[model samples]
Structures are given as C-alpha cells and as structure tokens.
Target: MAGHSKWANIQHRKGRQDAKRGKIFTKLIKEITVAAKMGGGDASTNPRLRLAIEKAKGQSLPKDNIDNAIKRGTGQLEGVVYEEVRYEGYGIGGAAVMVDCLTDNKTRTVADVRHAFNKNGGNMGAEGSVAFQFKHCGQMIFAPGTDEARLMDAAIEAGAEDVVTNDDGSIEVITPPNDLATVLEGLEAAGFKAEFAEVVQKPLNESVIGGDDAMKMQKLLDALESLDDVQEVYTSAVIDE
Candidate 1:
C-alpha cells in the first residue's frame, strides 16, 4: 500500500515554509511548460497537458500564471529551454535514491545535485547504479475515508493494475502510465480525492532505515528537493509511525 507514506504528505504535515512553496511552484510551472510544449496547449486535445493543468489548478495557482506557462511552452511567448534530468544514488544504509530535475543548464544542475548528495553524507552514482532497484509505476494515493469497495471496483474498471490499501485507511491505486489519467478521473467521478497522483519510481522491495539513519536520509532528500532545478525525489526509505 502507498499509504500516507508519500513524501508530499510528510512535507505538508511538516508545514513547508514560504521558500518551499516557491520551490514547488517553480517545479509546477516547469511541468506545465514542458507538458504544453510536448503536447499542444489545448488541454481537451492533449492528455498530458490536461493532467499538468489539473495539477496546477489543484495547487491553487492563478489562472493567468497557468496560461502564461502554456503560452511560453507553445512558443507564443519565449521561456527558458529547460532540460529534464535524473540522478541515481544511495542514502544511508544503502537506501536507493532517485532525483528528478528540470534545468536550463545540465552542467550547473549536475554540480548542485552532486554537492547536495555529498553534503548530506550521501554520494551520487552513475546511471543505473540504483535505478535497478525501482520500477516506474503510476501511483495514485487515495484520500482518507474513501469507500474501499467502490474504489476497488472503480479502479479495476478504470484499468488499474492493482489497488492496495493499508490498515490506516490509505489506499494506493496503481496503473500503467497510459492509464493514470483514466484511473484518476474514474476515482474522482466516484467522489474520491487523491492524496498523491503522479508517475513514481516505486521500489520493487522496500528497505527500512529509521532513527538516525532515517534522519540523515531525509536531510539528503530535503537538500535535493530544495534545489531549484529539482522536480522530484524518490527513495526506498521507509516511513511508518
């Protein structure tokens, strides 16, 4: 089960600061631009753009801001030419780590990412070094109190590959990347809100490294997420309280 173990929920519960919000907005803006550039700016005609726009809306971003991002992406307005990047590494106790980034300059971004890992007592690795431990999967986390039977039926009908629920009432609805939007819409129509909805690099098996080690790993993850170029961070570190 994905549970409430998603990093976003934890970060929210921790009460992110104004600076953190800015960072999040930056990442969201980049996503909107990239999605628009790849697909057309027409959300109805572009599934990826639709999903990105919905995500920006969920974040409460101003409509004008969203439109501007789309314009920039579609070349109606000039914008930074960002590049996507991924870095693999291991945190304390050999916990696999993955960092996703969007940058205008790969050289600077790589340096910043490497420094983040080294400063946090972790070290970045070559491609495929740690990625082997994870599988790219579409993960949709359900909000609390959603009806299990309804969710199960809807997920299955929406082409979800699996629906796993934790004892604490959190549910993880998994699907292929192609079916993520379909599954999310199905759940929404059934009146279920998602806690987290995105394509994630899920670990095939988890590793628990709590206490001091967990804290260290969190610091490393935090540092990476704090970087302006970073878009997401994934790790095998276990979180249960």
Candidate 2:
C-alpha cells in the first residue's frame, strides 16, 4: 500500500476530537436524537440508532442523557426537531470536502458553512459537486501494529467488502453502510477491536497535502466542524505528518 498513513490520519482526527470533547457530546446527542426520531428508539431494530448509541457510549455519554435523548426523539419528551443536511465543497489543493449537519434551521447552517468555506480559502459547492468523489460506507481502521494476516482472515469471514493496508501499515476494513454494526460485532468477536470505526463518507481517493495548503485545509475543516449544527466533516485531503 502506498498512500498517506491511515494511522496518522486517525490520530490527527482523534486529537482534534479530543480537544473538543465538550462539543463532541453535543454532536453525539444530536445524532442519537435524530437517529431515534427517524427510525424509532429501538436500537435493535434501527441500525442508525444502534450505531449512534454505540458512538455515544464509546464517548462515555451518561446513561441518563442517552435515555432522555431517545425519549425526546421518540416524542415522549419535547425537543427541537432537526433535519439532516449535507453540504459539499472544495478544500485547499482542490480536495473534496463534505459537511454533514443536523440542523433545525437549514438557512443558518448553509450560511455558516459557506462563510467558513469562504473565510478559509475554500468554496462551498452545490449539492453533489464534491460528493461524487466519496463513497458512503462503513470504515474501521486498526493501528499499525495490528496483525494483518489475522485481520484479513477475520475481515473476510465477517463479510467485509475490502481490506486495505495503508503506507504506514495501518489496516482498514470496508463494509456496506447498512452492514456496519454486524461487521463490527463480528470483528470484535474475533478479537480485532478497531482504533476507529464508523459509517462515513469515505474518500475514494486522497490528495496528499502539505505546507500552507495543509494548514489552510485544517483551518477550513476546523471552522466547519466547530459549527454547532455540523455533525461531521469529511475531506479528501490527507495532510502529511
């Protein structure tokens, strides 16, 4: 495998996330509430809700908070209704960018997203402008030292779509979006706990970015992710470590 270090990218994203732990919880709560609202509160029956709950628990969100969020989503408790919106754009070096948001007010979210893009030397694009460069799928990334042989066997047995080893030796398991939970469970059962796993808009290809372009890209991503309405930001730019 010859590309950016998957491990490094995971670490960079994790570092950014760790710095925003407070806001992370808010984002997780919103995801859970929205997932429940759309698919009912039963995690077993709703894969989206199940994944959201898992993510929230992984972040150590309180049980009471999770329960309340579910209740609110199910309309047992009143809460602001949110709608999912995705904005696509271009980042530094022409890297494709996608911003996923859970917003009660689409107008505010779009303005905030566009402002962030414009301010950071990027441009907000029309729907599907950059989305074509990505694929919606389940992605699980293992650390560099994980056993590739065993991982391959387990991933294949677990019905993974593809297994890729990055230049830095980190491994990635790809699965269908709807099969994420089942695949994750199988891999964990096989003792292959992932360092990072989620259903995401995975980049079909990456653009290696360094120098000032990388810095500007980070700024653009940070600005977008900092918005209260934004849930996730995806980019094809892989900053060199």
Tens-digit lDDT track of model 1 for 114-135: 9999999999999999898888
Candidate 2 least-lDDT 10 residues: 1-10
Collision pairs in model 2? none
* Runs with alpha carbons beyond 4 Å of true place in candidate 2: none
- Candidate 1: misplaced stretches above 4 Å? 1-19
Q: Tell me how far candidate 1 lies from the true structure as C-alpha RMSD in angstroms.
A: 2.3
- Clashing pairs counted in every model: 0, 0
lDDT of 2 at 84: 96
Q: Each candidate's lDDT (Cα)?
A: 0.81, 0.92
lDDT of 2: 0.92
